[model samples]
Target: MRVVIGEDSVLLREGLVRLLNTSGFEVLAALGDAETTLTAVEEHQPDLVVIDVRMPPSFTDEGLRAALVIRRQWPSIAVLVLSQYVEEQFASELLSGNTRGVGYLLKDRVADVGEFLAALRRVAEGGTALDPEVVAQILVRRRSAPLDRLTPREQEVLALMAEGRSNSAIAGALFITDSAVGKHVNNIFAKLGLPPADNDHRRVLAVLQYLNERPK
Candidate 1:
């Protein structure tokens, strides 16, 4: 996989370059600012971009805004944003559009190299990989009536789904059988009134419903 990194922190940026290099990824460029990152993307057209949510100058979402622009201009380029904390609004905005090839993880996740690499690979391969904390925030803020209809187990299943966990993964996390996970997923889809479609599409829609719903 080819990648470009955008992080203002010298230590983290160098660390990421080394990490990706050793993990079998070709690092095209390591940039410090959002503008240069965008330019690098245009120049390199990498398969994936690993960006910190904040960067140079004002240091308030410049990287995120650049990421949104990258998604707009190069939909095929996967984006994996790292943040110091859970920024629900940013995460929601990033996910509000096409959920494919997108990831939102906290910086703390980087310490777990194996898991972090898994998430990067997942996003690069056109899949979602939201941090567990990000998924939890979205679930907590969801106040839609349809969500209220879900049982506690169903809610748990949906939360794991939002985190982009497969049925077997969800079952393992919940200590349940795959059959039970499937049943709960079906129930979640039915309750959300999602029309029949690709199972992956339905899962994305279910997750979007959680993000799009407003308290009333």
Candidate 2:
């Protein structure tokens, strides 16, 4: 896949370039500021953009605004937003339109190569990949009855599910058998009123429910 990287940190930017290259991605350009990044996208029109949520000048939301503009102007290009902190509002904004080819992940997640690369590939292939931390934060303050219908374990499983984890991944993370995870998933879907469907459809439904719910 072809990619453009927009990050202000020198070390991180270089590291990302190396990582993507090593992972078989073609890095078109590694840029520092938002404007150059935007220009690069206009010029190269890469398949994906890996950008930090903050960048030069104000160092607060510049990269994010640029990313939003890129999505609006060049919707064909996938975007993966990396941030140190979880911004529910920012994540919601990126997901405001079609969730396809959009991602919001914590910078810390990059340390986990397997997870990070999987998220990147998913986004590049026109899928949603929100950070697990982001999902947890969004669902944290809610106390709705439908959600309450889910047991605590089910709730945890749903959170990871929203992060695009597979049944095996969830099982490994929670140190349980895959069959147990599968049961929890079915219960979650039933409790949330999600009918049987393909796993991706179910995932989108569950995530949309979590995103659309009002915090109590």
Candidate 3:
């Protein structure tokens, strides 16, 4: 697969290019800044982009913002973001819409070449690969929110939604009918104050609200 890399660190950028090259991925460009990375992606239209969460200039979410733009402008390109720490907000924003072909992994995972390459391959093949820490933190944030308005069943459905389960899968997990799961999902969306919109995925918005709202 064709790949573009956006990492500010010289050693890391070169290392990633070498690793991906050896793994049979064509490294179109290994860029050091978010802008250059964006330019390269626009120029090459690579199949996948591997980016660090922080990049040159401010070094605070530049890479992430660039990734978001890429996702919006070129939805076909896969994105794999690497962060030194569990930036829950970054992960939440990146996952707020259609999450296919996305990945968020910690930088430490690079040492385990097999796992890192597996994650890259999964994302390139239009699958998700989130770090365990990222998932745990997002769940913890959701749990800390004040959600007294939702019924117990609705809360259960919402939790399953956060796990990226489809309505049918949730129904199977809860041993309920698919219709029941749909009702619970709609209820969760209503309780979260999310109205039906033509361009929005209410299910994703509901989960995002659950993750972002603070305990009242």
State each candidate's clash count: 0, 0, 0
Q: What TM-score would candidate 2 get against the native?
A: 0.64
Q: Which digits, one per residue and each the tens of the lDDT, describe model 1 over residues 1-216?
A: 999999999999999999999999999999999999999999999999999998988898989888888888999999999999776555666776788999999897667899899999999999998888988876654433377798999988988887889999999999999999999998887677553422237788898886665244
Estimate every model's Cα lDDT from 0 to 1.
Answer: 0.86, 0.83, 0.86
What candidate 3 gets wrong by more than 4 Å, as runs, is 147-216
TM-score for each model: 0.66, 0.64, 0.70
Where model 2 places Cα greater than 4 Å from the true spot, the runs are 140-216
Task: Look at candidate 1 and give me any clashing residue pairs.
Answer: none
117-185: candidate 2 lDDT, tens digit per residue? 998999999998988888776565222336668788988888888788999999999999999999998
Query: What is the lDDT for 91 in model 1?
Result: 66
Identify the superior model by TM-score, candidate 2 or candidate 3.
3
Tell me the lDDT of candidate 3.
0.86
What local lDDT does model 3 show for residue 201?
Answer: 79
Best of the candidates, TM-score: 3
Per-residue lDDT of 103 in model 2: 91
lDDT of 3 by residue, 1-216 (tens): 999999999998999999999999999999999999999999999999999988889989999889888998999999999999877665776786778899999887667888889989999999999988889987776555456778889888888888899999999999999999988887776556454433567777787776766254
Off by over 4 Å in 1: 144-216
